[model samples]
Target: MSMIFSWRRRRAGRGRAGKDEFPDMELSIPTHFRCPISLDLMKDPVTMCTGITYDRGSIEKWINAGNNTCPVTNQVLRSFDQIPNHAIRKMIQDWCVENKSYGIERIPTPRIPITPCDVSEICSRIEAAAQRQDAKKCLDLLKKMKNLAKESERNKRCIVQNGAGCALAACFELFASFSIEEYTDFLKEILSALTWTFPLGDKGKSKLGSAISLRCIALFLKGDDLSSRKHAVLVLKELISEDQDFVNSLMEIEGIVEALFQIVKVPICPTATKASLVVLYRMTLSENSEMITLKFVDMGLIPCILEILVDGDKSICEKALGILDSISSRDQGREGMYENALTMPLLIKKILRVSDMATRFVVSILWKLCMGENENAVVEAMQLGAFEKLLVVLQVGCGERTKSKVTELLKLMNLYKDELDCFASSARFKFLKRPN
Candidate 1:
């Protein structure tokens, strides 16, 4: 009887294996093998406090999204501790091995997840090193943290959530008060680490927005290290506040504007260029916009902006145009624009070429250049087929303000119509039809 029973069990096992070999056979996976959150086969099964098992990656994503309850049971979790369900993982691996003929692959063992406790310990060590002014120790710890952040998004979130941002910010504030030559490496490391914690909390932003912090960043901007310069500008972009007083305070930093303009004149990267443009734009938002605009003009900002408008991507072009429009509000700014040979043609080309925002900016800039007793600007517009583009702007539709500006521009160009007849008759303007 025993021998017969053993034979029957072997027959049943073989029968299942034979069925699994068929291509069309539907393999019914065990229900417990699938994660509740993702409904996929568990690669790294972990049991939560609620006794429900889920794939580690899936549950961590759910927790990272700010959910505190078990996804399946909807029960509020008392603790986030996830224990590895080694038994289920082993079983899943065994099932995969048995179904290898069906193309199932075994799940590899998952690495240990970085808990908040691990991040907190590292942050504490960093803070201690900063307090003691141990530059070497601080550098090593920061590099360690940087490597961890690079490992995975989960690690980055863990580092930031565990107060690494504030720790690094405090380090910056402390070291920035000292001479730049004394702690160059440490400051660079701090800036690099702080950048990884972007979209920082309010506390970190406040700490970095201080005068000392800004001064340190300005010094880095003047440094020869390309990576540090890029990091400095990126960090500065995040620290810009809406307060007019705060915005004006940036001007007081010696050589700050010139440093940013240097980055624009000779871009280190597209990101740095955009960031410098953003900082310059925010500076113009203050009450002293005229003085600031004149300063920018003196620094040859007009030509740089025109060059960017010629070939920059859409976002960069929009930002560059915004700066140009602000600069054009003054006489010196208009003079600077006229001095650039590409100014009129480039602005006209961008009229309907880029985004709606770009078109509005171009129109505003043209209006500024042509508004005063500048018949030269009007003639230039007419000769360049600005009349046709303006008409198209009206026909294609635009904002009410843009429509008003285009109407005014058309009326101005009409005054020069007789003189522009030959120019308008050119093949370039052949497609143009005057609006009634």
Candidate 2:
């Protein structure tokens, strides 16, 4: 049997060659060695329960895309477990060695996949160290987990699935009370790891929402380590999103709002900036939001948001506009918008330019500022082409609420048309006639 097998292998090696298989040497690649999914020679072959072998990377990608059946056999995958086809791998490697002269390189041995058991062991060690108050060991383990998460999305899913998130949250809660000067490294590592293990279950979110956790995160926000500060903002955004009650505790933390505003003012990254904006928006949703809005107005949030409006991308602009609209609900917020010189021009420029949602926000802000006793805002907006922009918004399409505001703004403009020097003679005035 061995002789026959060797003879057949040699005969297969000399079989008919395909033009595309080995362009330079015209070598024949056995069809059995190619993966059914990719039609390429399988490197790191894995066998699914359906007895179909595919390249590990290809099959894993298929499953990650939410496929539950084997690609070739169309059989339901009873289990996700993929067994290594060592014999096929060995055969492929030997074939590559035989074809070394044709430029085929040998595939390196694949590393052992990270399993739930491996993650559980790591979490166990982290929990034990936290119990013993072993800051050094905990930091080392956290660094390991961070590195692992960086390796692949698979490792990250495994780590989070195996209770790594809860373990890290517990460590953060325990270590956060210590002196920042002493446990700064350990605490930073925990924050970094927690950022990777996001979409945390309710338990993890609850632990992270504790007052102690809020306080620690606030300190990190003010810390000089830009990475830690960004991570803290991201984690804070997650916590506030999961539990609205935590916003009350967050508001109580000294300097938290100011820190978030500073990040918005001088963004560390786009992600951090958006997260800060979201946290600020959530603060405006709390019961004491009137007070919060007043606080934001005092802290120069209006000008900061206007700056973002000037250059922010679509999504960030939407968030900034949401916060601004929230702030505009308060008397102080409207006053702040009126006081800033660039506010009118920026808001006018954004009227029909950004998006429908953004247009709605700008219209609401303009309505809040102009509908009141402030005539200069109306005059300023008219001078800055607000009349024509509203015309364009009408000519195009807008939300019903936005269309109503535009109509009211136009009537308000008409009330001042005779008073304003530029309104009567302008050709655009005809377009402002009231829509029946």
TM-score of each model, paired residue for residue: 0.77, 0.83
Candidate 2 lowest-lDDT run of ten:
1-10
The number of the candidate with the highest lDDT is: 2
Give a tens-digit lDDT track for model 1, residues 1-436.
0111011112234535552222254466787998888878899899999999999889999998999999999999999999999999999999889977666788887767677898888878977987887878888888888888877677788888888888788778877776567998889889987776765566776777788888888889988999999999888776673233556778888888899999999999999999999989887777788888899999888888888887899989999999988888888889998887898899888988989999999999899999877998888877788999999999999999999999999998998897667665686677889899
What is residue 410's positional error in candidate 1, in angstroms?
3.0
What is the C-alpha local distance difference test score of candidate 2? 0.86
lDDT of 2 by residue, 38-123 (tens): 87888879999999999888999999899999999899999989899999999999998997766678988776678999999998
TM-score of model 1 vs. true structure: 0.77
- Model 1: lDDT equals 0.84
Clash number by candidate, in order: 0, 0
Model 2, C-alpha of 435: deviation from truth (Å): 39
Span of ten consecutive residues with least summed lDDT in model 1: 1-10
